[model samples]
Target: MSNTIYKNGIFGPNEWAVLEDEADLPESGKVLVSPDRFLALEGSAPEGVELGVVIRAGEKAERLVAHLAKLPMVAIDFPKFSDGRGYSSARLLREKFGYKGELRAIGDVLIDQIPFMIRCGIGSFEISHAPTRRALEEDRLNEVPIYLQPVGRDGEVPLGTRPWARRRVA
Candidate 1:
């Protein structure tokens, strides 16, 4: 079952669907992973193999950016129920690294964290298989209206953070 955390009144994941080694990965399509297991090989990632990383909080997120900048996608890990590291990490990945690809939540994905995850720049989520009633309650939290503002404002000033704030989405 997936676990979720609250961020800015919304719920999100602790980690994501990560494959351990190359054998655990498929030849094509998207493959999830954690930072610790990522093999630093330029062009080693097979064609059509969209590798992802499951960051265990925002601790080394900034440092990993230069390395992750080469990848296609990354997922943040939340560990425990109260862990907010993934939330902060997601924000940095988007604002600092300028990751323009997909950011998804894989582990402990409850309902309430969805909205905040989106604000933090997460575009996809892996909902749990056996969600309890608590999951439903949390999910409703994200259902509220979200103003056009990404999570942290460059970790300093919060202003015009939306990627499309300057354009019209019709």
Candidate 2:
């Protein structure tokens, strides 16, 4: 329900100022991060200021997984939908990084990408414009049912050995 620009836990538009932009930033207990500026930190980011990071196309996704795991939330920036690097980054964050945090998408997000984005690990999405009819349909994506079956041999086992790996050995 919230509509705002974010990175890690910081918020900004095209340009942000350390002192002048206090009004746009969330309160001490809220989180805001800039995907573009996430490479660095600011004056400790209040108390509950969330942080966001931007992943570029073809960049090494593994390098940031460990760093992202430590944070409570992360937002991957998508410069444009045509650029698919963010998709792989999101998948790696969920499958490889084991990041159990709020994974959001910001910048150039549209309706068609919602379902795939959610599967990849983006729980929240920020569309630069007000939700268009197409965008609303994208929100309906939340209603779609997922059909994939239990992936591992625990069949539905809670967690023993990874099913695929065990099958490979068998």
Candidate 3:
């Protein structure tokens, strides 16, 4: 059961669909794939597929770095919200691999994690939980505006670090 995606802080529609590792790949639009499923594809796999890869817990980001430019999205699997490995994956994909595309948090995506996930470079989330979906729909998520540690594309300077955090002003 897929719910509306929380994209760019807006509760909006989710056009993408998640498929099993062994399922047949779609020919177009947004499709998220598991790492092993992605690797199993032939080098001659269909082009312009608008692919999004999902990183399971414990999966290394380095293996996906080379494919970053080719993929429009990369989703980190949370499996359980308590597992914070997705945060590391987001940071690596953004900070290290320089992936400017959409970084998504999949699986057990909860409302409370959205703000933190954004800090780690996750641009969107795949929410399936009813309470979570309701929370996002009611605009009850992403309330934190001030942050202590700076990360991701949002250039807000960390808390108490600068008077003019908006920009360099030079």
TM-score of each: 0.61, 0.55, 0.78
Q: Write the per-residue lDDT of candidate 1 for residues 53-117, one digit (tens) a residue.
A: 66765447765666766766777765655777788888878887788877776667655666667
Across 1-170, the per-residue lDDT of candidate 3 in tens digits comes to 24467786566777777777868777766678887777777365577565678889999989977777787778889999899988898888888889988888888988788878877878888878889888877878855665545442435654456543433211
Output the better candidate (1/2) by TM-score.
1
lDDT of each: 0.61, 0.56, 0.76
Query: RMSD, model 3, all Cα superposed?
Result: 4.2
Candidate 2: stretches off by over 4 Å: 1-50, 131-170
Worst 10 residues of 2 by lDDT: 14-23
- By summed lDDT, which 10 consecutive residues of candidate 1 come out lowest? 149-158
Full ranking by TM-score:
3, 1, 2
The Cα RMSD in angstroms, rounded to one decimal, for candidate 2 relative to the true structure is: 8.5
lDDT of 2 by residue, 1-170 (tens): 33344333333342211222223555544344443344455445656565545455665657665467556656666788798788888888888778787777766887667666765767766656556334453434343233243233222333454445332221
Q: Which candidate has the top score in lDDT?
A: 3
The candidate with the higher TM-score, 2 or 3, is 3
